[model samples]
Target: MSTFLTLLRRDCAQLLLGGRRGGALLPVLFFLAVAMLYPFAVGPDAPLLARTGGGVIWVAALLAAILPLDRLIEPDLELGLFDQFALRGISEEGVVAVRVLAHWLSFGPPLMLAALPASALVGIDGAQLRLIEWGLLAGTPGLAALGVLVAAITAGLRGGAALGGLLVIPLAVPLLVFGAGSLSAGGEAGLALTGAVSLVLLAITPFAGAAAIKSSRG
Candidate 1:
């Protein structure tokens, strides 16, 4: 238990505190940039912005999740950190689990906070904003899990970072659909589906990531 907490703290510092991998700020800024630029790109149609803004936020959050993918597992693998953990009797699955939590902490809540200003920039109403927040809360964990899983799979490959981003986009379509769809009238069911998908991804990520890491090492 103590060891897990230590790993969690170390990873959160590396990801959240900008220790070589860059901070959580980049994703938040990118998210805000998407919101800020979207209004200009689509013209000043307030109704259009209000209707489409939730989807834009969902897409921005997805893209923001990508920015940190390369750093998630690759850096540790390169440094032989996994071997050290193994020597200490730590399983890859356990490390992966800790990483998923840390990665989510690094970006998820901050994105939720950033969403407030982003919601205004995109012209969404308060009711829709509330749905968006709920959707993000439920969905970002899956994003974090997916990011770590992809990073583990692509850790040793050439151009792995770019590959990881491409992989994430297609794989995350379900999350995007349900999360954004939740904002529509009579679409509350979408939020439940989004959370269900998140739970599934979370359940699978640790084992999948552990296998990927082991395979890479072989």
Candidate 2:
């Protein structure tokens, strides 16, 4: 029990402090950048911007998810952290579970906060902002879980970061569909579907991540 807490603590430390490639800030910055730039590219048509903003946010969030992929599992593997956990009789699944939680902590809230400013930039109002928030809440878990799974799978491969990013896009299409769909449709069904997908991914991530790590090690 203590070990699990310790691992979780360490994972949090890595996210909040020890970030190798870029800290937790990178993804948030990327997300905001995307939101900020779209107004310039598409021209300042208010209704058009408001109408398309939700989907833009969804796509930005999705790409933000990809930012941490290369650093996700490979750094821990390269540092022999997993080996130490194995030596201590700790299950890789537990480590991966902790990692998932930590990753979400680093990725989710900041993006949500950034979305407020992003919402303003893209001409989204309070009501649409609320939908975006709800949709992100329901969907980001799935994104985080998917990111971890893809990271584990591609950790040791050549050009794995790029590949991982590409791989996650298709896997995350469900999230994008339901989450973005909720914006215009204003229906609970989309949020429910998004939550369901998130739950399934979260349930399976620990085991799937563990297996991927093991196979990559072999």
Candidate 3:
């Protein structure tokens, strides 16, 4: 438990202070602002806003998710923390898990908070707002897992941003499809199933990322 707290503290320090000023918050805010812009760009037709809402939110979420992977593995690799953890008694699996928790806290919650206003702008229903929140809650762990895996795979690459998106976006398609599809369908069972699928994706991503990271690191 202490180790977990230590890892969270370490990650927060890096996010809040280690990079360029406002390192973590900047990307999150950028996504929020961009999401807000879409309604204006598309004009104020109600149907259009409602139709585009889910896609806008999902795509913006995906883009926002991309920003963090740039620094994800680099910090540990540069600071020798990765090797230190491996040497000291932390399993790579444990390290990855803790980092995911930290990453989610730093990135995911802020993105979700930012989503609230955008959700309103996009004309999401109250029930749909809850569904979107649930989908995001369940789905974002997968995003984090994908980030760690891609960050590990592109650990030493200069073009990691390009590579990370290439690797992650395709994998995230199901999340977008089902997430948006649920709200479009507008049935109780549809929403419930969508949330269920999202939970399944969350369940699957960590193990897959864990396998990928172990393979890449080993």
lDDT string, candidate 2, 1-218, tens digits: 89889988888888755546576888999999999999999999999999999899999999999998888899889888888888989999999998988889988988999999999999999988998999899999899999999999999899999999999999999999999998885465898999999999999999999999988878
* Order of models, best lDDT first: 1, 2, 3
- Please give, for residues 128-160, the per-residue lDDT of candidate 3 as tens digits: 787777777766776776677677677766887
Error of 1 at 61 (Å): 0.3
TM-score of each: 0.99, 0.97, 0.85
Give the Cα error of residue 41 in candidate 1, in Å.
Answer: 0.6
Residues 127-179, candidate 1, lDDT per residue (tens digit)? 99999999999999999999999999999999999999999999999999999
- Report lDDT per candidate: 0.96, 0.91, 0.71
The best-first sequence of candidates by TM-score reads 1, 2, 3
lDDT of 3 at 83: 70
Off by over 4 Å in 1: none
